[model samples]
Target chain A: MALCQTSVLKVYHAVIEDVITNVRDAFLDEGVDEQVLQEMKQIWRNKLLASKAVELSPDSSDGSHPPPIVANNPKSNKAANAKAKKAAAATAVTSQPQIGGSSSASSLVALKSSAGMAAGSGMKNGLVPIKQEVNSQNPPPLHPTSGAALLQKQQQAASSGQGSIPIVATLDPNRIMPVNITLPSPAGSASSESRVLTIQVPASALQENQLTQILTAHLISSIMSLPTTLASSVLQQHVNAALSSANHQKNLAASKQLDGALDSSDEDESEESDDNIDNDDDDDLDKDDDEDVEHEDAAEEEPLNSEDDVTDEDSAEMFDTDNVIVCQYDKITRSRNKWKFYLKDGIMNMRGKDYVFQKSNGDAEW
Target chain B: MSYQLYRNTTLGNTLQESLDELIQYGQITPGLAFKVLLQFDKSINNALNQRVKARVTFKAGKLNTYRFCDNVWTLMLNDVEFREVHEFVKVDKVKIVACDGKSGEF
Candidate 1:
């Protein structure tokens, strides 16, 4: 059955009323303004009317309203302001790690203080002191190579067998500084990920624009020099583990089916090796192999259900047609293998219009 | 099954959009938004159960696809004709997602 547009609107109004009335106590307990709840309802109604799926009376919105929400539908600009503050704080944190290792520790302190201020203060003016404190700590490097020179000195001191423990303690904090900086860029911007790698060299050692080439060469050489034997051994270990686990599972299955199946166990081992190869090369042939394996080992390991209930609903929304019905099924039975459905409490979006139904009966076959 | 699936419907979608806007403005937390959605679930269920009194009957030329899993039925129909009172609406394709009716009772 089809419902008229007016009834759809009426149902929506009741839903809005019930939701707001029910949720008001929670909002009140949280110390949130009642006005915000009203604003949300107003925005919800406005958006529904804007959909143009149904004609709503213009006077309904204009008449007998209690402080109509701002036309923009935003009640406050707090999150935007917080984002701006966070961006500023992020730049400050990222720049500080380079000055000195000790400074990195202090930058953490500054970050925490700035974050606290950002959260508690509604006024932008409160952030000025925090920014200024961060800026004061970010003194210009004495020389671009000073950090490298310090690292060189630390290494020299360690090699000389002098008190290397203090130098090591100072160096450890800078190594961890990158991890702290990674936390601030919530947007995951590429530019934020690119940190300044200060490479120390004598004036004659580097030419302009050659640094990137040198860096890339070093990176490639390091990658090319990977320990192949160690990697092979690790991979071999993983394969052995999988084979053993698969064999154990097969044994479990065999035991459950019938005892003393040695010949079957040997055949299963060979099949498992083939399954491993198929898993490694997950191509069209692997799917056929998997089906074969499923037929034999169905009792050993049930294949995971690739689609669960959540994705089922998501796929419904993802379906091309908006002509969809979401309802409750009271009974679904097959008479002579022809499907009959009895459904109720349904909401449907069909042909760009909304509908609500109390009962639905449907018939289909195979 | 809960009315969370209804969030895909027009009314639920609009309500969610409104709540999202409020959350973005920092006027509400995600926790409160969740509470609001729960309320919406109950509200929509009750409204549909008690307020709406329409009955619909439909016949499909072909059940293009049918899936039953997790006690839910997802059926894709082709050449659907819905009859309500004296009105008839025909659509080329429609998808039906039905949850167990008795399972959602609170």
Candidate 2:
């Protein structure tokens, strides 16, 4: 069981590294420098990664594994740093063999069989661990209803003496280097006294939300939701909140008169610096506000100019080299009115293939 | 960089206001933009075959425009100048397609 968790951790770490390295590569390919990478690192980690970890990890009925540094609390900053390293390194070797073994088909079948008996979970909102024999190749949209039934079947799969509580990774587990040491500041400098910590991410987090997906089944829900564990950078968190708040806003239906929309949108945007919950009913007009994140960039010297200040027209055209990769839902013709399914991988670091087509004649809902 | 852009004439003020509303959301399509330009120009620059080149940076869609006389650029946005650069104008609309491009030798 411990081996399984360790491997899961390793997989998630790999995913994060791959995502970050890919961003680094994308910038480098465009001849950008390390400063850009450093700037993006915090945003990506805080906005996407840490939240995803909390999203995917199964509810802790998986046994209270020593409460993580509970009694053996480190005394000083140095002591804490040293303790973290020892714990990280000690688990690396034991999990290495499990990582290798899980990749083979025979072991996966055994793991699945064992997991079948470990059924009946206390997951929130009645979410059950995927009990079906997980087939990685043909990934299906695991709807809520289907997930529950699948768990029931898995419980049946577990015969006398063998249980299915432990989910052997049934997805494509990518190879990732276990641990990485990142310096918050340059070594040998005065700031070098700051904690130099070794972080371990589960390679699984990068490769596939395989673990997370099994737990929640809410993959294609909305473009702007995150898990509780989304820690790391405070700046990115605020940005994420702002983005999600903006995206999920109930797009106000534009009337033919457009008088209400004009006034309301103007007021919402003006007071936006103060209240983020300002929802403009007309999102079509507010389309590329995401691009204007330049205003919200904490590191940049963004002028304290409000939308009202740029009187002549606040519109300016910029090149689309903003390093966003898009994965848009091709068939958005679903019966659920209009749903935007974005599997943001660039990190598709993207906002779907952006194309301006078929303008609506005033009375459209979405 | 520090001139009162919306200076003097009624046309300049109206064009400035119109440009803000037109491009407020983003770029408009060429066909849509042409219709918008016609509202400002059909009576003013009243010639059947007067072809116009769009000079960016200056929001003078309503006023009569000039062509780029020399091979030099006209406006500068984000360090890149608006030369005979039609390729960079793909995802964007020609918001200000005026009579000539030779506004100034920047």
Write down the TM-score of every candidate.
Answer: 0.51, 0.14
Query: Which lDDT tens digits does candidate 2 get at residues A62-173?
Result: 4533232331232223345655776788789778765564445354333432332233221111222222332333232234233232333333323311433333244233
Q: What is the C-alpha lDDT profile of model 1 across A130-241, one tens digit per residue?
A: 1111122333223322222222222222233232222222232213111000011112233222121222222111111111112211121222222444433433344345
Q: Report residue A188 deviation for candidate 2 (angstroms).
A: 91
Off by over 4 Å in 1: A1-4, A55-62, A65-318
lDDT of 1 at A195: 22
Candidates 1 onward: DockQ, in order: 0.52, 0.02
Model 2, global lDDT: 0.27
Docking class of 2: incorrect
Top lDDT: which candidate number? 1
Please list the residue runs of candidate 2 whose C-alpha ends up more than 4 Å from where it truly belongs after superposition: A1-9, A48-366, B1-106
Q: Tell me candidate 2's interface RMSD.
A: 24.5
